[model samples]
Target chain A: MLTGAETEVVLLSFQVAGWSVLVSVVPGILLGWLFARWHNPARALLQGLVMLPLVLPPVVTGYVLLWLLGRSGPLGSAWHSVTGGHIAYTTAACVIAAAIVGFPLMVEGIRLSVLGVDRRLEDVSRSLGRGRGATFLRVTLPLSLPGVVAGAVLSFARALGEFGATIVIAGNIEGQTRTIPVAVYTLLNAPGGEPGVMRLAGVSVAIALVALLVAFWLGARQRRRVSA
Target chain B: MIEMRTRHSVRGFTLDVHFESAGPVLGIFGASGSGKTTLLHCVAGLLKPRDARISVNTRMVCNRPGGTWVPPERRKCALVTQEPLLFPHLSTRGNLAYASGAKDALESDSGWKIVDVLRLKPLLDRNTASLSGGEKQRVALGRALLSKPEMLLLDEPTSSLDAELARDVLSLLLQVKLELKVPMLFVTHKAGELMALADDCVVLESGKVISQGAPVNVLSKPRAIGVANLVGVDNLLRLEVLRHDEAGGVTLLAMGADVALAAPLCASAPGKTVSVGLYADEVMLCLENPAGISARNALACDVTRISEMGHEVLVELKIGLQSLRARLTPSAAHELGLAQGTHVVALIKTSAIHMLG
Candidate 1:
């Protein structure tokens, strides 16, 4: 039985995580393919840069995001100039922070699966009169689809748990950016908030467990497809 | 018709090949690692050679060094590799219709003809992963044919199969050649397949074209020692069918002037040339025409050449205008005191002479 405030926090968390996955899906697939297929000396460096958020301290990542979207920052100023609006401390900022924190997991999952595909199959497709793009869409993408879906689900789970980035950039604003992790954090410092924190923490654990199981199942399916 | 001149080097292996063939089915013959597949890849536009000029059916597909470079998809050359690289996610029907225009091709009368030829009608709904090796290859061939390629590129398409299955596939390929009449560039190391399918042949040894001609001519008189070794037969002769003894179940072939060799019954008409292979080890050398021998033929001949290979000796005997090679142990050669220009009788059995195509 979640209180009204708790329900709002849970709902907002879903909205933010959902948006984060939606915004990152295309770029994640593109970067994942590049990481898997590109044969250049600089590819490793670019991949490392994209994967930085996965290993870096979340608080530090949040601070960097804050600087980039802060009023004085170039991007922040440019946004203000283009739309006469601000991007900081908003729901959009919450989505951006969560998406950034979860991106590396998504990309790595897709990259490994794409790499697992047999390149000879693509050659056969080409020889059968399918162009590169058509072959990718028909052969490579379908073969690696399970992995791509797993990556998206994993990122969504990661976004739901994102606390440090959301707190720093979007702040713990109620009903707007006060996601489950932020709400739990907020409740921890206040008196008579242990019950609320317990419920949110349980929900978070359940969501994480389900996400991991789905990812593993999808990963197994991908291995079977490639091996077959 | 196809013409190719290309050179490519990878790691330590180099592929330098040049040949022109007017073929309904041209066979590229070579042993493993001899650049047969590499040459096929180059022609299929799957591999980019360092210096190359390739034309198929009078249209230039590739000309490197600031010339036209057509991609593989547009080359109209469909390749069926040794392994059936079917799309794993798709069913057999789906894989058969995967090419750009294959869906429409599947509905065409010609498409049904291909399906019938490959015997793929029953396996259409089965998952690709569930098909056996032979079934998979049949589907692969059908898929390639459905693409309506200008020329088919087959890279040892039957090598992975068992002997019986290989023969079945080979016959199917023959049917494809005769009934479908699609131009093809078939690659294989099997001399029999080359002889049976190719209108013209190119023999490759270590990345170079050693010989090019009709299959029977090139294979019968191998230009290089390497080709002779690859062909694995000491004697490959093209002889005229002299006559057939139906009751005796044998056909007589003219080997040379006034000399005839009896072989197993064949359908070749009299006066037509037929290629036959005989292993050197199967020929026996005798100093005199021995009596009461159960062997079929004992021909008196003069030893023209004697070459020692390892523990054995190869004795080349001249009978009329033809030469037949016989293998003997060092002890046997020494015991018989065999030498060049020595007169001896070469014994051969009818069963040992294998009719090659």
Candidate 2:
């Protein structure tokens, strides 16, 4: 029963969040593993740097991304020279902003899960004639599946509701970068935009409820398997 | 041959020892914090020692001078830790196949052989989390065997199991040795398991090799009395198998000129000397031989030494040329006037003597 504009906003929101999670999952899992397994003095520093976006304001993060990717910036000038296109104020910018804001949640979920895995399991695997790499793929990764799944779902939900950063970097272009949250913000500011706001807010709650249910189901299943 | 001479020190606990073994199974016997597990870890290449030279079958796995080191996977020494760490993500069959690198090949002949020997066919498809402690240990052993390891290093593998389950696992290990013919290093604090599984033994105490020799020699030697007392088997006598009376279901053995004992049927031939184990707690000391007693063997012995150990008093007796240890309560010792140079009768039940192999 969504209007044409509402339907466009919904589809754009999914597109932006889907791209954001898809691009960040691999790097997020890698950072989680590095934090879990690597032993070094700088490990705390690296973890703090990755978690900075979780505490910093979304608008500030967006400004930093815009400064780095704007046409006048070094990377933006180099890209413009090669391809003659701008990166800021685009759909790509919205994906980048959402991914940056959601990355900490993803990495944190996976890191805690990875840390929960027993290190003695890896030693047993190695004694079974498997190398370190093979053991990671066979034992470590499989045991940490619940965390990975939870991380992906959380990052996806965070990206779907992103607002301040998306508007600051990507702007509220209709049918292009106007994600559901950005559209809802724009609608509430205009005269008599209350009904549209109610619809979009309802959709947001539905998505978040589904994501949370999925995470709970996965975590419970993992615990049952462990204690079976 | 497995030979290791190493020194490792960390956090006030150090392991410094040297020994060589050419037997099928070597026993590393010690108390809980005696560095036995650390020595096994070094032999398995799980941990590198500070100064060391480790060779297995003439191939140097770790050498300080040559700067050669082999990782655990390359060392081909399968370590079975005290906790049976089966992969919880996989089923019992999957864990065995994981070791063989055959994704779904449990139907293979070698796989079935291991499954059959371990009596694990009924548990093949079950998830490891569903298996009991003893069942999980069987699966762990099966997994290690399937990997075709050059040697097996067991770190108190049966310590977590109850006495019955521990005996079951130890019997299975003996079967594995018979079938697989693989060199193994069994580390344990139990004297019974050490006697059952190992031919040559090394005793470690506080990160040093206190005794190294045949199991009987090391366990019964006067210098290793502390080790023997720690293991709870204080009296280890060398008795020759004199004859067998199959009708009585017993084998008669000679302790000396006048002292003889009957044991449960063993496979030794006549005149073959065998070491018989007796726990100090099992021996009953009486000032006068009691008629109508259930115990069959009563030998006259002269007490050589007496020592107080908490509530119990350990009395060493000289039976012919051999020594026997008997534990008595302090009150009983005082009432019986048990002291060195006293004459006493050492009565032992026929079933209490365990044949050490």
Candidate 1 Cα deviation (angstroms), residue B294: 16
Q: What is the TM-score of chain A alone in each candidate?
A: 0.98, 0.95
Off by over 4 Å in 2: B64-66, B100-108, B222-225, B231-260, B263-275, B279-295, B298-352, B355-357
List where candidate 1 sits over 4 angstroms from the true fold: B222-251, B254-260, B264-274, B278-357
**Which candidate should be chosen as best, given DockQ against the real structure?**
1
TM-score of each: 0.84, 0.84
The TM-score between candidate 1 and the true structure equals: 0.84
Index of the highest-lDDT prediction = 1
Steric clash pairs (candidate 2): none
True contacts kept of each: 0.90, 0.69
Superposition error at B34 for model 1 (Å): 1.7
Candidate 2, A1-228: lDDT as tens digits: 789999999998999999999999999988999999999989999999999989999988888877888889787788899999988888988899999999998999889788878888888788777888888889988998998899889989999999878888899899879999999999999999999999999999999999989988877777775565
lDDT of 1 by residue, B213-296 (tens): 888778866464356566444587788999999998889999787899889999999999998888788899999999998788
List-wise, what DockQ does each model earn? 0.71, 0.51
